[model samples]
Target chain A: MKKFAIGFYVAVTIALMIWGYYQAIYVAPDEQTMHEAQRIFYYHVPSAMVAFLFFAISLIGSIGFLSFRRNRPDWAQASDAWALAGAEVGVVFCTVVLITGPLWGRRAWGIWWTWDARLTTTLVLWLIYVSYLLLRRFAAGPQVQTLAAVLGIFGALDVPIVYMSNRWWRTQHPAPVFGGGDDSGIKDPTMLAAFGWNVLAWLAWGLLILGLRYAVERQHQKYAAQEAQEALNEVA
Target chain B: MTSALWTHLVKDLRIEWRSREAINSMLFFALLVVVLFSLAFDPRGAFSQEIAGGVLCVATMFASVSALNQAWAREIRHQVLDAQRMAPTSGAELFLAKVLANFLFVSIVQLLLAPVFLVFYNLRVEGNAWLLAVVLPLGTWALVANGTFFAALSIRTRNRELLLPLILFPIFMPALLAMVLATTSILTGDNDPTLWIKLLAGYDIIFTTVSLLLFDVVLHAE
Candidate 1:
């Protein structure tokens, strides 16, 4: 039953993705001024949204792991699993955002990038999680979870500072405002519907992967525990 | 304030005083970085004022990592970390003392480098000169505090030296921006650096408190 349900969900997610792509590429009218380049928005913005949502999930999981470690070891393990999964998935989506944004910018803005508040913050966010992933890859011992949780907290704390620090530059030539009119421009009915579908589709896909990643991490943790138990038995 | 913390600080300070190994090494590495940037960027005239801030901060960052990589190495030798775990003292104090010791060493290097920097870059403090004093130390504290905590966090990892900067640099990005911009603003007299200074202070306080609070968890991890 479980396998059937997961398979069903995967099939539905694929269908949603195809439908979303159709809506984005064909149904959504070309945006004025930039035309085809604006289509990147459907994929780029939704991926960014899903990425932020997952990173927030990672932060909550880190906190949950730390608080629950003493009283609820099993719960702590589950939380750490979520933490790792969220960070991993978030980084994947964030990488998409970083790449697609530049492609769109090169066409739309006539330049590849600018050191604006949003762009810089997104870049820093990507760097922090990439390093978080590196830490997981390189670190060892029984305390990996504990150390990762601490770094997770620190990384999340810096996001706001990173955002504001760029703002502090207060340079005479202001950062080219990418999103200055972006929020309200979505009110056009056709674009809104297409955008809505793409957002839903990407989020569904991201969550499915996140869930799979979580389950895999949990299984790995259990396998390692069993291996350690076997080693202890041999020593005994 | 605590005597235990003072004892840890004093012990580190005394040991460092004897060898001056970290100091000498950081000083030379930082000097090389300065010379390299001078050759590469050709910090000439007005442009020098703009980039010197970034160069100094990068130099400080690279030099400090060498010290930070070994911040906990001494404790790890001969099972000294295990002994610390057995003691009743708070892990936060030990973390703080290490930060302080490293901060002092980095600051001393900065102080020594200032004269050389002035000659090399032809620096003239266009804004308040006293503010550099405030800005430099605040920035140094932010770097050292996070570096020490992270050094301890990475101590058990396989690639200890390599992992420290990989993890530390990203988290250190905002402070690096504040330090570089604040220093540049002061140098150029472009605008008030009070905002960046405030941002650095807040970053220092928030990260320091969190590091202290979390050090116990990291120390007792099993």
Candidate 2:
């Protein structure tokens, strides 16, 4: 059954990607101002949203891990697994966002990069999570999990402050195109359709990746537990 | 709790006075940073005034990191932290005491650096001196509180010197931003520090409360 599910997921992801490519290339109307360069938005924006979503998941997992360890120690491993999975997946999507963002900017703004609020905040968010992963990897001993969880919570809390500070400092990036105001958003239904389909496809991809990562984490935890039990038995 | 805090604070100060390790190094590091900044840019140039805020804060941050790194290292070195673990005082009180001691040490370093920063950067404070005064201590508290907390967290890690800054800097970015901005306004004679001051105060209060509450969890780990 698990193999079948894996097969189904792979097949569905391929199909969705193919459809999204077609819609972005052929179906979506050319944006009046940016023309062809604007097509990158269909990937860039959704990737960023997915990245933020994963970070939020990691935040929830971190909180769950800490609270569970404090109040119900039996369930702490599961929470730790979730936190690890969420952080790893979040980093992947954030990398996608960072890459696609510069490519999009080179085309849209005629510059490779800008210190805009959103851009700087996204970069800082990536750094925070990377440090989170590093802490987990290097901080050895029994307390590593708790330390990483604490760092995760701190990183999660900093995200909003980062965004707010950058916004107040300066903003060279374009105003939001959707829900920004009456002055923005797509007027063409085809453009909206393409955007909606691509967002759904990316969300589906993110969930599939997260599921696989979580399974791997759980397997690793199981192996570690078995090894420790065997060692205890040998000592006895 | 207050007595516990006072006792720990005095103990840390006495240790520092005897050895003169952390603060002296921190001060020299701050001075070197200022000197490096002066070498990199012309101090009397028009551009220096514009960047003076960033220069001063970055130097202070680097110095504070060194100080914080030493703050936990000494305790962990002699197994003093292990003894403290058995003390009757709550973890919050002990954590608060360390934070207060670190705050005092970092503030003194900053106080010494300020005059040097003015001379090295050729900066003149055009805005209210009172505003500068408020911004300095509030910003220092914001840095020291989080620095002390993360220092304790990172002490157990291998290569803690690298990990401390890695964990602290991202968390410190927002407060640093507010501090630099408020200082810039003061030095540039902008005269409106209300927003930045509020940000600094808010950050200090929130982190101090959160750190005090969560410090016990950090101590109980392992």
Candidate 3:
């Protein structure tokens, strides 16, 4: 299983790297409004989508852990590792979105950043994941895992409400040059196809990262158990 | 069932009454939160109805979290949960007793401050102040139900105080939104205050019901 994961990771990295390069160079038209800088959306949007997908999976794994409560500690740990890796990638994507988003906003809306819906929710989501990682570091053992699992489940539930309330509030209380308007002229077929391909590439990258992280977590758990056994033997 | 329920609540009250430590600390903590909030947004802004409403909601939440952490943390630290499990009380009775105790504490804070908030904010609350009496219990029910279960989960972990908010902020968003919107509308005197009230009531029902059903699984999860 580990070998298969490693092989798959190498193949996916090569494929995505090539596809990303191709999309950037050959396709994805130069932005008429913001010129070339708008191209970052190709990577940024895909990263956010993939990260959210992994977060959803983490919730599923948690529910499974709660219901089953077997010797499947590895599965629980794997899910945690997947979530961490996804957040790592998502944060990078969010960073690009945060940086280039403001740049794009400055060009289009005449402000570096606006306290608008998408921006605020994204920022909050970033904080939640940071806290999630911190919680894992602070808490360990079965009880800690259960607490983190409950947290993961609840945190995922918050995402939609956060998005909805922000949208509602933004519409009601408008921010300068931010709220009110969706001004994409047309959804060109080529751009749509490019986006589809990029999303696929991003999903592939997410799988590889999750797999690598899962392997590392499993090894760490095994090593910890071995040390405990050695300590018990020494005591005996 | 009634006797079991009575037993749980009576035992808890007896234990709490003996120490009075938990309740004292919780009350002080709630007061500290309110004062800090007032200071945090003062001079530049007096505690208007809007500010008062927001502060009251947040302070209640913080106080509930602080108190719930102590309630369940003490149980695990002392292995009282095992003793309770072996007692003649059912899980439901135990749950109900915890909920009642938490509700009583939170309500005391809310009641004591209700008039003070009105006076400080320079506003008259009309159209059934009794309505809030109904709303507070329902809201407290939801918060305490989930708060107890999460508190149980957090008891043995390190940095539990930090973990509680991280896990809670998301679960409590719906309640927070409902409470704020309902309270704001009530203060502003909307023609259809029923809408926000119904939303708050619905949130309370949904969360409390879900938490009650899940409390058994949580209590035994370890």
Q: Give the number of the best model, judged by DockQ.
A: 1
Q: What TM-score, computed on C-alpha atoms, does each candidate reach?
A: 0.96, 0.97, 0.82
In TM-score terms, candidate 2 sits at: 0.97
Whole-model Cα lDDT of every candidate shown, in order: 0.91, 0.87, 0.66
Off by over 4 Å in 3: A1-15, A31-37, A71-103, A110-127, A163-168, A171-186, A231-236, B17-24, B43-47, B85-92, B126-131, B190-196
Task: Kindly list the per-residue Cα lDDT of model 1 for residues B1-222, writing each as its tens digit.
Answer: 488799989999998999998899999999999999999999899999999999999999999999888768888999989998888999988888888899999999999999999999999989998999999999999999999988888887888888999999999999999999999999999989999999999999999999999999989987
Question: Model 2 clash pairs?
Answer: none
For candidate 1, give the lDDT.
0.91
Candidate 3 per-residue C-alpha lDDT over A57-156 given as tens digits, one digit per residue, 9 for 90 to 100: 6667667656545667656566555555555555555565577667666666677777667776776676666666666778776555565666666566
DockQ of each: 0.88, 0.78, 0.37
Q: Which residue window of length 10 is worst by lDDT in model 3 chain B?
A: B43-52
lDDT of 1 at A88: 100
**iRMSD (Å), candidate 1:** 0.8
Q: Which of the predicted structures, 1 or 3, would earn the higher DockQ when compared with the native? A: 1
Q: Order the candidate numbers by TM-score, best to worst.
A: 2, 1, 3
Docking class of 2: medium
lDDT of each residue in B1-222, candidate 2, tens digit only: 689989999999999889887789989998988888888876676677778888878888999898898888888877888888888778999989888888888888888888888777778778886888899889889889999999999987877878988889988998999999998888888648788899889888988988988888788787
